[model samples]
Target chain A: MFGIRSDLPLRRDTASRFVVWLVMVLVFMASLAVTVNSYIGVLIDDWNRSVTGTLTVQIPIAAAGDKASAILVNKVLDVLARHPAVAKSEAVPRAKITALLGPWLGNSEAISDLPLPALIDVEMATEGTEAVTAVTASIKAAAPEAVIDDHRVWLNRVMSLAQGFGVVALTIMLLVTGALALTIVFATRASLAEFAQVIDILHVVGAKDGYIAAQFARRALVQGIIGGAAGLALYAPALALVAWLASRVDSEVLPDTALPAAHWLTLAALPLAAGLLAMLTAHITVRRALSAKV
Target chain B: MALGRKKAEEISGDAVGLEAVGLHYDDGPDVLKDVSLSIPQRSFHFLTGPSGAGKTSLLSLMYLAKRPTRGNLKLFGENVTQAKRGRLAAIRRHLGVVFQDFRLLDHMSAFENAALPLRIAGVGEAVVQRNVNELLNWVGLEDCKGAYPAQLSGGQKQRVAIARAVVNRPKLILADEPTGNVDDTIAMRLMQLFVELHKLGASVIIATHNESLVARFPFPRLHLDRGSVSILPPLASSAEFDHDDPRG
Candidate 1:
């Protein structure tokens, strides 16, 4: 598969440079998307394992009157603290809640006067969704009007983003694969046209159509490998910079952004995969082109 | 080799048999009309024709490069008029053709060019190198073995093409003006090589415009004019091809 010698002068063609560059750019984007998609996989697993079952207990100011809302929060916190699954429980101070709303409404003093729900933050220790159902009854017994959020609001949004990005990355790789195949076909035909006379001579010398096609296949394979390696070289640094930026973000919703070391080996194999793709595509292209002759 | 799934010697009457063959390009007048020919195995013939006399076209047919537009064509006694492409390539393996343009691959060295046929036949590298070196030396191209076509002279390129054609020792040898670019001395030497192959078991057909060169070989001639053929008889007294003579 790695044979280099060929009867066609494909190396002399200027289109090789164009093909190599196109493949390089395409492979770089594909590697980046694929690696990011890989990292997102870890993030999705983390979200499912640790974050999906966490809950928030809220006492709306409307359901329980403003003064009663404060009392209802105390009952819920006591109920959560007594539960076996609850790892920690705390009531969010009214001043802190008002401060969080300062960005959209006004200053803390202006927003503090308004009615707002009493919020209790609970961290559940267990990893199963059953933990949410087990504690729901206890919290409701303490305060019947208590609203329990399994944190599904932001959890579903982030989960959707991760899965959506994975799908988008997959689509990008598909487009890259299609474009790479087309590039090989066009380049093979151009190389074939450039060496048409040489091929005719090979035919006269009793060389089979497979022999001639193999020469072009080798050329395309070489181009694919070189271009793939170069593209991966560019992608490594780009991905590192992205990981660094992602890790630096302070949002609580973001998952661990560090990529594992073993994935580099998988990414390293992309060059050979690209080479095989180029070889197969080129072989089919040349055989079809030559079949039309005489 | 026969065009069908048959061995070379299994089905045999003539090496080549063409019955009322007609050919033409798309929507064009017939380049060859009602062309009928019968050449026995191991026989040598010269194809003589004017510029547009379809010598190369006829050679193309004999080597199975193209099928006749109409009528029956046979190689090694197998009818190939309706044969498959793979069958045509199988038969082509036994036929060697030296094109008029000296279509040597510009990328390959002269030695590689000559070794191409043997390599395609799945011969080992050692045998390819030995036989190619021997043949290149015979064509007086021993020194230029490592040279590419672009680096070699016109006559040198023609010699490389000839070496490539004959290196396989095929059953039939066809050349279109194989000696067009070389001097009379080298030309005669090259023709002597062809005659040697003919002496062994290969049928040979050479197309040429040089009458003096034709006068030296005692082979029968197939003369073509206006898309038709006429047979020319050989000389009454056969003359030997002198190996040492500069002018034979």
Candidate 2:
């Protein structure tokens, strides 16, 4: 115990600095995960509920004077409405199309300059992809000039991509935690080596191995706890910033759905767990090193 | 020569005894070979040899740091060849060792370092304070009791080491080159302290290269030549002066 107490100052001075840095890094990563994950959760939920039953119809004209295109869109809409599964349909006005294109084509530019296809937004009654596929096939057979898109393919792809990203973020967190553990192990080993002669002297004076090992363990525990707390402290604020930044994104592009609370809780638990793991790793490593000697 | 405990007596009691002991490190040359000697109860002897003559290695064996590759080593009358780790630790609690380098813990203050043996043995705080202070004062280091090892001079650190070694009044005390780093006056004083300990019934073995010390002290000399030990005659005649200090 005295051996451990004697190393308090040196342990605090060096270990605290390392712990602070580790906490900062962990907090940054945790906040980033929470922020990015919340956005992904929102996107997935929106796609599953709102976008899954929706489809779009576009009519492209081969000539400058083609009233047939508009006529064909109306026909497709009528056919879709008669089906029992079809809920509603609307012809997207040219103004809405121009507004959607305003980002790429400046608002000052005339819409007439470009030959834009006339589009009809369609809503179906069912959620499954099979219903949309069957309805699309019927619409295509009736009007060859019309193109039907149910968005299920792209939305599925987007969901898969988002999940993949979440996994990557989680993996990065694991790697960072592992690196921190390795760092703690190395530092503890250095400390043990530095005090090798001291340990020998103590043993000669009838200090048991348990007595010597306790000193190292105690020092590491204090370091681990303090470092872990510091890391968590940094993590909280960074996550708050992420939440703030997420809240400020233009709702027109990224909607203002409340962030997922579970993700934030997971972020909150990270530093504490990492700190404990580091402490345990340091203790075990030190004990093993000492035990291997006389 | 005042052989406090004979080899036969040590065998009958729970005390340390070596018989034809030899030690060699793994994948290294032999460090100790065929060294047979007995240190009886309340006896004082000085080990004399040149540098790298295994004085420290012999002392390490005395402290149970390593086992002999050949021959029997008995501590407290139990054969230590198959001694369990727990039993070894228990035996070590009654032993004290002083290193030439002092080996005081750099992290602890002088007082704490000196009190380590008692602390390891689970002595109470009050007892520790009393004994540690007296030992510190005996070594003339009472004023710097709170100072760290790094803050003290080489000589001061040596004194602290000596104080720590003898603080427990151990059954056995082994000092390897204890006076190597001190002045002559300090060295003699330290030797006198060893003499005082020997008089108090603690067996002591001092290993040094100082032939002058061997000449001055009328004690048995164990000479090491190329990893072997040979006992020499006592420097002082036994009956010259019964009036002179018997331990000295």
- Evaluate every candidate with DockQ and list the scores: 0.58, 0.45
Instruction: Determine which window of 10 residues in candidate 2 chain B has minimal summed lDDT.
Output: B1-10
The alpha-carbon deviation from the true structure for residue B155 of candidate 2, after best TM-score superposition, in angstroms, is 5.4
Residue B184 miss distance in model 2 (angstroms) = 8.6
Error of 1 at B22 (Å): 0.5
Give the CAPRI class of candidate 1: medium
Q: How many residue pairs clash in all the candidates, one count each?
A: 0, 6
Clashing pairs in 2: A23-A231, A27-A235, B5-B40, B14-B76, B15-B76, B15-B77
User: What TM-score do all the candidates reach, one by one?
Assistant: 0.87, 0.70
Q: Interface RMSD (Å) of model 2?
A: 1.9
In order, the Cα lDDT scores of the candidates are 0.84, 0.75
Estimate, for each residue in A1-294, the C-alpha lDDT of model 1 and write its tens digit: 355456666657875568888889989988987786888888887777666657778887865477677677777888888899989989989888888888889894657778888888888877566888888889988888888988776778988988999999999999999999999999888888877887877777666788888888888888899999999989888888977888788645566645667567768888888889999999999999998987
Tens digit of per-residue lDDT, candidate 2, span B73-122: 87656677667665677778778888888888777899998998888777
- Residue-level error in angstroms, candidate 2, position B34: 2.3
